[model samples]
Target: MTRLPASCSFTQALVNVINVLSGIGLLTTPYAVKEGGWMSLTLLIIFGVVACYTDILLKRCLESSPGLHTYPDIGQAAFGVAGRFIVAVTLYAELYAACVEYVIIMSDNTSTIFPNTSIHIGGIYLNAHQIFSIIGILIVLPTVWLRDLIGGVGASILVVLCLLWVGAVDQVGFHRAGTTLNLANLPIYVGIYSFFYAGHKVIPDIYSSMKEPSLFPLVLILSFIFCWFICTGAAISGFLIFGDSIESQKHANKICSLQIAVCTVVIITISKYALTLTPIASGLEELVPSKWSRSYGVSILIRTALTISTLVVAMTVPFFAFLMALAGSLLTMLITIIFPCACYLSILGGKLTNLQMGVCIFIAIVGFLIACDGTYSALIR
Candidate 1:
């Protein structure tokens, strides 16, 4: 029954949504296109349309009950306590996976800048990627202790502009015409595209924060439209510039290393890593008894532990594209597509027409299939 203060303006809400949707995902779009070929850009468009529809579905669910504020609140309203737990876990896991992606990005880009760098500490050797990853974790640790959010919106957009500069102003011309399609790898593209539109878990919070919640739908629409173009532009331009050879996320970094693309990615990842992990850290703190959790030392301990864990995962499974695909297919699919429809139908079934019910069921089915397909594809790769 908790409610957020109504403070966000329409423009603020739009910017917030765009920021969340256009994270490290933008940098990976070309790599995703390379994975499944140029024809797979259709998946990006398809996912954008469907994910936007589900955002509306989530809004409808929130409107059905005034008590709903957070995503878990919608879940509790839809199917009670178990529903809340499911939504909360899925959302947190997705955020944590995103943190891992951030670390991997920073590490990859750092290595890109200093290709032969390495370090040795206590007789244990660390290569450039591992050393830089540890440094990234340390750099972001202090940000986790702060309460305010300093996100990476500008750096992501800067990356798109950098791509353009690399292709046009620089000599990296858009001459490589890629293949029309490749069915075998399309599932990987699905997961990555699914990752592109995964801001749904925060929609309820954004709606609650709005000065006029009714304008929330407009915010969602505009946000999706804007981000769609950004993702599409990056994909089309990156693929054309780099072609099929741009097979991994690191290659996206390689696209414009001279344009300080790696530097931008490093900055974006560093800025976003703590902001992304803070919610999960706060959630864990809430689990401890109030007196202990309120202690400054305890809070720092929890946040640092979380950051270190993500660094370990980043170092262990360092394949950025495959990991992102796995997270998108397994986590983003559930959060952005399946659960929203399920909750909407559960909460508002009585008011819906038969067509509405059928459509929800159909969308849920398609989301589930994509999740399974993409998860398997990502894992095997």
Candidate 2:
């Protein structure tokens, strides 16, 4: 592919990177801490390092070949059509899972705002959570019809500030004497931490849009470090405030300023479903003939079908944190960690020094273990 003109400045690209890294994962930090003990917080740092490294690997893969412009493109360059297919399917699955998580979170918070919400249709009964999940998706479904829009990153900052205010000014002291380590629950937190930096999928676009493409590595480093601090602060503050009783979506139940914070995230969650699913819908449209792909009716049908699938999945498995863990482990680990290293080694292995090859192999092994252990733990718990 011909090189596109670069127009995005350093600051613009930095913000875009942060926006991709920050998402519903912000709400689960405390729960993750509660699950694996305080020491498990280190996993966030470890995963951040691994994510940044793998992202650089992806950038190297892109730089090695001018034809590569996306994650699937990297896969194809490294292997063949099969590699592209696998990467595309995994990326789409991860995006779809994220949409389901958004529906679950929106429903979870919406029910908190109106606790008694419920409905009856014929012989079927729907509780507040179920009713709200349907409403949330219906509200979000139309946004997919409109193509161009951007997402937000301020939610991460808002959540951190809220956690601080509630703990410092509101008198929720940091007095919890949490365990130093709980090896039994370590896998769960590993998966949660992985989800925090699952932004590598979009790095190619960010790379191509950069006014200074060579500085992409610097941007990746800064974004990951920034996100790591946000996650750490939220984890410590949230655990200090809520302690052992802190479960997934725990912030939604807070009656103080955190309630406002939760509502803000809820709005973001509702708004993000369309942004998440649009790519998947477009990919499906591409599978059809060109004539049908350009038809508005066909486009709407694809978008509606994807939205309805997410709704069904969200309603079936309503556990927010668990669903996140499952997605992060099964899909995100591959997209963010395993596949990047694999592709880099495959595409550019001839140029790598011994140390570089060893490092890539080491990181890939660690990523695979984390994916397996985390996936099993998420399923069992």
Candidate 3:
């Protein structure tokens, strides 16, 4: 076997953690907090801890099973074919949901930038949704086909850009509204915070890439601390600047002078995320080999499909609150809450503590209910 690179450090591993979490969700953190309040911060802390603990557990499992290559392999080693199937299903579902959400966000933002230019298809005029979807597919195809790709550095660059954008927005928002945080909004804040901190599944992939897998626990602790601090700072600053009046602002119109800065950051950040998700859609093709055997062709097709579907939904749907809620409450829960513990217990074997089992079942149950509730709410409202 080829030896792993000695230069790989914990910081590099942490970069992977940052890369995975620094997707479109970062942009939505402020919106989620606006609804949840300070409770969002509390949720971040709680979920962050759970995420870290789960990471440690995953690292342990990876260490114990030397031959386990992918996550599905680990599942198989732990719980036979049934376990593999469960993990695969959950992983696919999570990725599918993530892709859908990304497409939706991109379409919405694009429409905001270009309100005119409609394409007439069937009996209806093609709107921003159709346009953006086509655009999204066109953009995502190329990046998906390359094997052994390393976009972590690119993602880091985007993260820096996003930070700068947040700084600019915070400055303008703060100047206009002053530096007061509304304590009454804690619950909404916690819910939103949870949304941002929900990228735990990527931890093992990060750990495996590290020079020393054993240090992942420490890496996770420090990384999450930094991420939480940054998120909290951004959230407080954004809310202080825009308050609850953000939606009323004209599309592509920055709410304050700093909004121009925010938009610049948003465009770069979104581009990076769109690029990152391309690989996920490509991976899906592996499951359906008959339809997607050609990497280049499938990648292009998936991206195109996603982009178009997202743009259509965005143009037709005036609001994204329901979609975001569904993504957060259901898909996020599957990846963050349910899968981790389930994989851990299966790998470890034997019996789990009442507390451990309880938490696992609770997350699954709650996630299912939330998904159902959100779906129903979306249909009704």
Candidate 4:
């Protein structure tokens, strides 16, 4: 059995969980909740329960497979190369698409935060979006190539403070904007709810990093509780803060754009860029032959190419809402609800009780239905 140094404490584990799970996904919660009206709350709770349940299931998966270092490893162990392919394609594609959207979102907010700016250098003018995009690339490039964690208690503390600031900022917006409480929007936002709570991809990494891996269940539970509170706070406060005026801000309040840029949006885009790119990069590394894996020049070239490709997409068809909705309903539903339950059943080899079987089928069905409608809704808009 191979064991990495158990350097992460429970507190560090908790903060890391919060940081990973809470990413830019929290930024969309308020607007999502507002979209489905009060009906969204009940859906959010339902999705939260499902998310927590599957998290435990995935943990059970790790316990069953000792040598698995990544989620694709788990998939391969469960169902061979096809399983691994499904995970790699779905997981990496989801993360890749998500990172691209963040690029657009970052640039969008950057323009708003620093709008109408034109800098002249060598008699050439640069737009604010261009300036910000270049800054984003420069800031993210080196970080993406480093293997050490950019996410930790240190970054997570900032995340928590920023979230609290968002809540407080929204509260002030509520008082100033005088948003009326209305719960009459259509209630088919289960996709968004599932997206908000989906954090299964990070579980295996966190589980491996722990001093006492057995205590991961506790961390998972506690982290879920912390995340749930912040999400609910953001959603409820934002409902009253932006209410009917959500269309103007789009993100849900006066400071939404600013918060999105400074808090976790760009940081997440930068930090997770490498994280999301890992599976693909690993594949590329393999193609380059074993001896070249340690070549710094090759690694930098790969990272730079990946970053520029994502930037290209971001600049092209930058449909922010569509991307989030797609990720939430289509991609997140699979990782959080469908795949875990499927893998669990496969591992048990049909030895489940009637209740166990029923629960699994039900959750899968719920996720499927939500993905369908959510995709449709996103496409139409």
lDDT of 4 by residue, 1-381 (tens): 112246888887787777677765665666766576665666666777788899887777777767876677778878989998898778777777767766765666666666787799999887876677667777777876765545432333354455456556644444333223334323235555667776777677777788888888889888887778777766666556556465522462233455543545566667666666655665666678668888978877886788888888776666665567777878888888888888877776467888997898888888777777777767666
lDDT values for all models: 0.84, 0.83, 0.57, 0.68
Per-residue lDDT of candidate 2, residues 1-381 (tens digit): 112237988988898888889877867878888788888888888888888889989999999988888999999998899999999999999998989888887888777777887788998999988898888887888787776557778766887888788888876767675788888877777788789898877888889788899888899999998988888898888788878777665454542235777667666775566777877888898899987889999989888988898899889998888888888888999999899999999999999999999999998898899899889988998
Report the Cα lDDT for candidate 1.
Answer: 0.84
User: Could you give me the TM-score of model 1 versus the true structure?
Assistant: 0.96
Q: Residues 1-381, candidate 1, lDDT per residue (tens digit)?
A: 122347988888888888788888877888877777777888877888898899889888888877877899899998899999999999999999999998888887777677799887899999988988998888888888776665757878788888888788878788776677888787777888889898887788888899998888788888888888888888888877887677575765575465377777877876777778888988898999988988989889998899899999999999888888999999999999899999998999999999999999999999999899889988998
- Candidate 3 on 82-167: residue-level lDDT in tens? 98787767665655555566555555566566768688777877777567656765565444434334434343334334445655
RMSD values, in order shown: 1.9, 2.3, 5.0, 3.9
Which of the two candidates, 1 or 3, achieves a greater lDDT against the reference? Answer: 1
* Candidate 3 runs further than 4 Å off: 1-7, 116-124, 128-130, 148-172, 175-191, 248-284, 287-319, 349-381
On the 0 to 100 scale, the lDDT of residue 128 in model 2 is 88
TM-score of 4: 0.85
Backbone collisions counted per model: 0, 0, 20, 0
How much lDDT does candidate 2 score? 0.83
Residue 101 lDDT (model 3) = 61
227: Cα error in model 3, Å = 1.7
